[model samples]
Target: MPCTQKVTDDIVWVGGSDRRLALFENVFPLPDGISYNAYVILDEKTALMDTADAAIAERFLTNVEGALAGRKLDYLVVNHMEPDHCAMIGEIVRRYPEIKLVGNTKTFRFMEQFFDFPLQDRCITVKEGDTLTLGRHLLHFVMAPMVHWPEVMMSYDSTDKILFSADAFGTFGAFHGPIFADQINFQVRYVDEARRYYTNIVGKYGPQVQAVLKKATGLDIAILCPLHGPIWRKDLGWILDKYDKWSRYEPEEKGVVIAYGSMYGNTEAAAEELANLLAQKGVTALRLYDVSKTDSSYLISDLFRFSNFVLAAPTYNNGVYLPMNALLHDIAALNLQNRQYSLISNGSWAPISGKKMDEALNKLKGMQQVGETVQFRSSLKAEQLPQLKALAQAICDSLK
Candidate 1:
């Protein structure tokens, strides 16, 4: 059976969720699974917003056919050329032989590189502010280059006031029954995953996201139809505000995130102590994680959410701990910015992880060290309590 939902009188949600996938992009963990969203806009000339991943191709194709109800798919919009969204392009083209593919110039270029299908006259190349009409619906294309991808763009329906966002306001989670944001407890259920998705997958392209947000202000959007997760028909401003803050590289709240990598338990103990001390000092929003146990994507998400953080790691082969080293690399690579951080390094003989961690973090924009690097030999002793306490106080003070 074709499982789908109605977005409006003429628009139908023809997407499905995949819960068995272990990881998203074969990197980020998807414990709660993920959803791939596509919409079918039925008008005088029908159009598909985008396509689902190959993982759910059977179900997706069925849903599309069901929504079309024997009608022809006139236009297939390619908002983001990423494989997850573009995987069904070839299959869709096969199904709808006369369908015209809609995208920007770069979109067609990437398409040629990815598929061997003959485009011929199937391409409808558009640019920023381009409009495509399907009866009463007027779709205005907004070019969002590097808003995570070079060929990315968002389509706005002028008549329905719906914005077909590519990946801009997406999250990581599978929908059970409800597909609308207001239908679920979004803040409690999906906010963390949403942050993780944005910070890790799209964090590096803050400026480009900002550009898209600015362009979106011109449109009168009443519904947000992203390519993943839940659809937004209510509380539009709340999600938009989140995007505004995240794209500007601003912390969502005043807090501390302490991530530590330890071979044994020495570094973990120190991180816990710092977290405890900070919490006792009136810092309510505090999180501590073992880099070895928790995924770096989770750590990166919190790092973006909180204003302050502490990195603790023991030296390994004269370098920062392996997990912590990789986390730092991801953080730096993502261009995480405008935050304060502290460091704790440990080693049996030579404790240089602090210095190494400090150097790696300093390369990022607007990263300020909140306290002096706390270095300990072997394990933290009574004598080191004062230093840890001072570092904790520094982090707490910065939170204020």
Candidate 2:
């Protein structure tokens, strides 16, 4: 249903929509659904970009058939080897018997591993900057290694000047009713999805992304056609700008994000006290978010905006609290740098959380520790004002 969206004169979006959420892998616990996007470029010779995941293979083929009418598919380019994007390759090859599967060596290697080398007979290996002609359309394949996967490359249509990025600009959530960047409030969804995608999938490959960006520097790109989400025909620089900022591991602003999850009122009070103290010290963008109530997106947004972080959690069986641990597991994927932080922990008897946090924070590069962390046995009482003030003062000093 979403394939009917217009991208350019010759390019059409033939992607698949996700009807049910928590269906990404049919295993992971996902509240929001995912979309598998594929495109068909009807040039003088028809070229259908990557096929959608197996779940939507039939619909994806339908859309392609609709676009081609009776025209034969000349090329089926495989950018990523991920099952979600590559599962329908065998079927596509079966339907379009004469279509050539274009990809780099790594792509074909993965193709062999997946479909048992049966489809390998129709494969075409391409290197970086390799050009393939489909009728009058000239497609240049740029090798994009480790943007998220090893066997990934992007195809550029010279005639239409459209960059068919494999998964570089993909995000979560489905686009069923509305398509295109201008059709919906992209900010509401894309911002969070981008952070999640980058942190989880693409954050580790910053240098490779930079390489792709550098390779694309001289090209005259009018539209960026990614494998997922609504097509970008307007404000193309917006997503690229976001990639630049995120890839640099840059935080949004100079502030502190005090996120905590507490079982009782003890941790909450400490967080509140620290928040007030930071506010009193003229920290403009200070925010205290409860991880139990807030979604991962808001947490990521706060983490993105602030340079300094402070966390409070109670120890559970020598480990951190569930919500706090969950947040840490999520943040570990970010791999952020130049971050200044402090900690507060509660154990009642055994105080392992403070040291655990210390080790965890130390593993993070460029994470500057301000001062001694404040460990509370039960709660902050009347006598710990000096300690609390010192903690606040240390955080304030780190901000400078």
Candidate 3:
């Protein structure tokens, strides 16, 4: 039996979720797995929006065929050329030989490069304002270069006012029956995973995201159909607002994320002490992470969520700890900015991690070093309590 959901009277969700995959793109940790979304628009001439990952190709193909109900697939629109979504292009063409594959020039270029399929006469190259008509439904292609990928494009359905976003409004985590955002507690359950997905995967292309958002503002979009996660049919503004803030590199909440890396628990002790001090000072929503234990993907999500950060790590061989250094490198590489950060460095003999960490953070844009660096030898001694308290106070003040 095919597992699918109806997005509207005519639009059917022909996507599937993969809960067994440990990592997405062999990088980010997927604790709750991920969903690959694709849609089928039923009209006088049927069209499939995109294809799912190869991991779930069997179920995805069944869902697509089931949704079509024996109606031949007229067009297959290529949105993003990522393998996760585009892995089934060859399979789809093999199944539907007469189907017209619609995409931009770059999309075809990447398609041929990724696969050995001959796409000479099968390709329908479109441009920025290109429109494809399928009786009552008309899809207008909006070019979204580097909104993550160069060949990325979004199709707007003029008939139903639905925006077939490739991966712009996507999130992590597999779907559990309910296909619409309004059906579940999206904020409580999926928001963090969503933030993790965006900040880690698409965070670097903030400017390109902003450009697409600007282009979308001119059109009236009633539904948001992304390549992952649930469809946004009810509260479109909620997700749109998140995308706007995230693309601008703005923090969602005014709070602190304390990430520490410890060798023998000394640096961890200092991190805990500062967190307790902040809590006693009435600081709510404080997030603490062990950089050595927690994956950098999760840390990056919190770093993007909170406005303030307190990084505590001990020096090793006259340099910053390996895990902490990796986290900072990822933060900078992802182009994260417009946030305040404090540092706590521990060294048994010579303290250089503080200065080294500061130098690494300095390479980023709009990152401010708050308060004096709290340096302690071996462990956080009683003499440094005042310094820790002062750093905590600085973080709290920045929150306000």
Between which residue pairs do clashes occur in model 1?
A: none
lDDT (tens digit, per residue) of candidate 1 on 1-400:
8899999999999999999999999999999999999999999999999898999999999999999999999999999999999999999999999999999999999999999999999999999888999999999999999988899999999999999999988999999899999999897899999999999999999999988888889989999999999999999999999989998999999988889998888888888888888878988898889888899999999999999888999999999889898999999888899999899999999999999999998888899999889999989999999999999888877877
TM-score, prediction 1: 0.98
Q: What is the C-alpha lDDT of each candidate?
A: 0.93, 0.79, 0.93
Give candidate 3 regions above 4 Å deviation. none
State the lDDT of candidate 3 residue by residue for 71-110, as single tens digits. Answer: 8999999999999999999999999999999999999999
Candidate 2: where is the Cα deviation over 4 Å? 1-3, 23-32, 279-301, 322-326, 393-400
> So what's the TM-score on candidate 2?
0.90
When 1 and 2 are scored with lDDT, the better candidate is: 1
lDDT for model 3 comes to 0.93
TM-score between model 3 and native: 0.99
Total clashing pairs for each candidate: 0, 1, 0
TM-score of each: 0.98, 0.90, 0.99
